[model samples]
Target: MMSVPNLDQLDANALRALAAQLVGELEQRDRVLDETRQVVAKQAHDIQFKETHIRKLTHEIAILRRYRFGKKSEQLGGEQGLLLEDAVDADIAAIEQELINLGGQPSEQKAVSQPKRQALPPELPRIQVRHEPHSTTCTCGCQMQRIGQDITEKLDYTPGVFSVEQHIRGKWACRQCETLTQAPMPAQVIDKGIATSGLLAHVLVAKYTDHLPLYRQEQIFARSGVRVPRSTLAEWVGVCGVRLQPLVDALREAILNEPVVHADETPVQVLQPGSKKTHRAYLWAYAPGVFQDLRAVVYDFTDGRSGAHARAFLGGWRGELICDDYGGYKACFEQGIAEVGCMAHARRKFYELHQSGKSLIAEQALKSIGQLYEIEALSADLCAAQRQQLREQQAKPIAQTLHAWMMAHRIKVPGGTGIARALDYSLKRWAALTRYLGDGRLPIDNNWIENQIRPIALGRKNWLFAGSQRAGRRAAAVMSLIQSAKINSHDPYAYLKDVLARLPTHPNNRIEELLPHKWQPSAA
Candidate 1:
């Protein structure tokens, strides 16, 4: 047998060279492992995403079902239901009209170009004046001839805008005689605040509604020859919240009192109360109804991504919580809260799974789910009783079949496989998943809340981060009111303007009527 060479016989230099080579190989292997880990993580994320979307779609379907079939109550009385039904019918009508318009457009029309604006007129004439001593002088030695007629030009400008002027005619009489008194102007959003109700409303709209930063607003004011300090604007926003907090607090109480509520959370970077740099916080949004009308959407802020933060905001309340499939909400479930997932979240997963050619299984599952939604669509304009009847006759069977298919496919699937993971998630949450079919009040998904939250996400791209935790809370509160107003088909800026104008004088005892739903525009 050949003897193996011993390391003891090798020189120090040779051994050192071999050790160096081994170290390099080990480093390369480690790098490969790290890369593999990242890929695995991304794959896991993609799978979870598909599962989440399925939950979203399911929640949305439930909500549509309730709106279609739920019994009339104080929350959704006769008038509101009719309004909701009309809205849905109008949407369908609009969609059908749009399709017709799209089909009517000719293929050749795609080549048509839009007309451009006309350019400004070129110079027509030049006016020049020359003073010269000439023989045409009348009395003196200097003479002048007119090259063109001397004319006076009137400067054109926009007509000065006039505002309603209130003349308070107060009369006084002798002490022994009869007396007369005049009423004071109504209180505004700001107490003795320099800005008018309209101006404060404009500032709030610019900062919150339009997503313009205070510094940028200052620059805009400067362009208009008005000086508005950034610090001052920030103070106004803070003060505005303080004045509006009573309304927000009332709205939150109203929202919590509702049978069903929608919820969502988004990340916000807030400057720590005392720290030099900003910290990550969450803006938790809660809305009372799927369709906004009188619904209250309240936002709460917290310093961390813990379930306790969510629980604190929710308190001892136990209502149907509509949200995405984030594990963070699992704690809420443990705390006796009901969790309703979103079908949109589930659809999103399949959509992502479809990106990989391996999504055929998920696609099939989605088709069945789509059938459930279609059944709900049939009851869109029907009353709750009628909708319940249709669900029993139509939707119940589809849901039963869908549930069976998910179960049958569950066993054969791999624990970690994409489709298997989705099946497991749905099956595990099956109780909540199927709860919507039984109750007319629960929504199928949280898409309505998600849609409301989306605008803030878009604004975040430009604004990047909030200046402070106080700032984030302010943003959430204002956005809640603004988005709620938008959902009611009311102009957010106009509604806010009106609220700021009347809220001060509006009685605290009748605050609920001042809530977005009961608010009506009175002649200014």
Candidate 2:
């Protein structure tokens, strides 16, 4: 260490310079301290935020556990019970994953032991897969002898058949090396997964297409001589959903490429974060026009029925949109997207009035609308040009006469009456309603998309609600491919299996080839 000089021995100028140096050192020290404090504060804040998140997750898990194990009255019956149990299993899995992500351990629950399983059916075909040692020679140059073998059987399912995969692993050991060797396990869609691609496909098709929940699948698998846990099945589903997202993205782009597209939205319930309750979410479906050769539909899931979601999805793709008069789409129309209204919506208003059996005007309106539908039926088999010609010749006159008759009747009816409101609905949107007459490619109603949404509606009765927003979107993506596969007359299970098997190595730029419309099953 250097020795300090006496202050009295120094000159006045030197003393002043010394004071300046001291002041500079003090400022530098202060700056360093300030920076250190800022870093510590940030770290503390981060730790607090993480702790809060962990507590919230812990609370959610507890609630789910209670619901899963609580009262019998809370439980449902039949198909709904299966769906609810599956949902609980999925939610628990999802929460555990989140906990793991947060650097926390998943709370352990004791597994309930199951009874002895029944033997598998004798009629089902069994495929043997032999896993043997690559080499019988040891490091010491001694030949190894074949010892015993272990055989494990896993039940696998194809669409309509159940098969058993007999995995035979042979044991080989050398006395010199004192080592045993067996062939390494093959890679699968899920690492160390007992499920085969065929089994995975069956689960997916059953869940997404058949709308059978995971718990139901669990029971089914149990019946087949294996008791696969619902949690494991949910994990597999999550993995498949992630793997299949790229294909869904490609499908969305294809749907948007068409000149005329069908757009519609349906409500689905989604569980809100950190709560036991759920909120309404919308699944917006888009498809190419009925006349377009591309037979595919894509679904987008949004947390709300906001027009912004539609605008974001459509993203400057100026095309004719066939949809009902929902104000959510008004913004889209204002942005220069051509709106082709559903004639069915207009007819429904009059149909409702006629059903009331109180309005002659409504009956007249239905007769006129019926004439329009008859024209559409006649043109169904015709080419676009011929269909348009027929529409202009036949349907246009009827629509004009209907418009004139409605105007004449409106003056005779009271302002707030049902018939008056029905008339206003048709007249106010007459241009959009009649726009389909000029283009044969446009559908007469939003029924095509409505039909596409029908399966989702039916599925809601079984599965009840989506577990979360991510789950909703995942459901939408998988359903898009499934429904699109059906639209193209391809088997959904075959399509999904082939795609899932090839997805890991399938070229990203050429992902469109895996789409339902263009996909061809592999020869192998």
Candidate 3:
């Protein structure tokens, strides 16, 4: 090849032009690299979001199927039948196949046909053996004098049955003088009643823990040769609530004393007094950590979503409040409680938008959000202090970048667009959004409260609705106790059974200890 033109030998103007061309090419290469990086990031985000959405939808599908087909085989009403028709079944199968193609599992109809083995008796036979021995002389010494008898064989017995004999002591009057004495009876779950505490405990657990509505429970009992009315069980639950109210109150007090409290609300239908049908209400839950030295969660029910309800529940106490974006909490925050917005809620808005359509704005906003979440995920493996440090160093810059992006693009995007709405939501709550950055103790998302609401949602789907507002409140109170007991890893049925059995006689002053955190198992 011809000798390459020497730039050093060229005039200064030409060399300067060559230098500018080299610089432009280098800058173009950098731009390509950046574009490639953004494309890769977007692809990764899309994959992750799609995978998560699939999981959520799959879970919901399973739950709905359980609700629909898991009900009794009997017809729900005259029009609705339990089994799916051929066409509907085919459609469902086709839909399922499509999902499977997209990596969804085919729903299995697991028929547990147990291997047919010999059936075991509910109770085992009690075996007893006896052997007897008599003194024996050698065969040759038939006439030997009688020797002391020896007991060679033995008989063994075990008492297989236990009998409880209740003694109602009698009062006796002396023949010569009038003198009467009688002993008082010990406390029990029910006085002059046949059922034991264990049975009542089962009933409470079946009704609340298992989400078997009292009416359904009554039907089940009828199958077992008992004829209890649904109303009777409802009355029983109400009576149990009345007896256990002190414990619930104590738990509330303890929750109020906590340093960091989490609160959430869900709708409940209640049979309000004088109403033709059940009315709408809410059950608000509160949980505290550190302040009350509690590792337990508590729930409270109210007939309304008014600030008064939260104020009453919180009792004017001030601490970190972890909650969603419900306006009802505005009052509490206004009154001096530090409010931390849940990032899960913020992420959810964009997630919903993304599912509705792959709108560019929603995608962009979500990618921006992904950056923050990625930081959170990485920091999960770090200790609190390290996480705080990482957040300050790594997360702060990302957040600032996002802020700058939002500001630059906010006006260019239309107001009603999904991404624009998401951006506005974050911008409006920007202060609360950044609150986690300031403290390591705070969570990045409101998933705590979201998780708290899941059980109620499941139960609601089962029962459909409450009979009335008072009934709804009752459900809330009972659920509060049950779920709090669950959070503390206590046996809910056993705890409720004991609470119901003891509250009638338990001293009111220390009832708070019966709350999940303070509860101790009764001495053996």
| Residues forming the 10-long window of minimal summed lDDT in candidate 2 | 110-119
Kindly give the number of clashing pairs for every candidate: 31, 0, 6
TM-score of each model, paired residue for residue: 0.64, 0.74, 0.63
Which portions of model 1 miss their true places by more than 4 Å?
A: 1-186, 273-276, 291-294
RMSD of each candidate relative to the true structure: 28.1, 9.2, 31.7
Candidate 3 wrong stretches, greater than 4 Å: 1-183, 289-293, 378-386
Candidate achieving higher TM-score, 2 or 3: 2
Q: Can you give the lDDT of residue 236 in candidate 3?
A: 51
User: What lDDT tens digits, residue by residue, belong to model 3 across residues 1-524?
Assistant: 12336876899897787777778888999999999999999999988876776676466446434533454542133211211111122223333433454576745552242122232222333232222223223344332333222221111111222112233333323333333333344465444433345555666677667877665666775565445544334435655554555667777777777667788888866542222254667777777632224665566667778878888878868988988778878988888999888877787887888889977666777787788889888887676688789899988888888878887888898889777888788888878888888776677877766677788877766665554443455566777788888877898867765665576577877777678777787773
- Among all candidates shown, the one with the greatest TM-score: 2
lDDT of 2 by residue, 1-524 (tens): 23457999999998898888888888999999999999999999988987888888788778766766767676655654555555655566566666765788766662353123345556669999999877888888999988888876666777656888888988888977788877766556665566677788888889988888888788887776666777778767866776787889888888888999999999998864334566899999998988888999988999999999999999979999999999999998988999999989999998998888757788888889999999899988898899999999999999999989988988888899888899999889989999999888888888888889889989887777886676788789889999999999998988888887777677899999999999999987
TM-score of 2: 0.74
Question: Model 3: clashing residue pairs?
Answer: 259-291, 270-468, 270-469, 271-468, 271-469, 342-446
TM-score of 3: 0.63
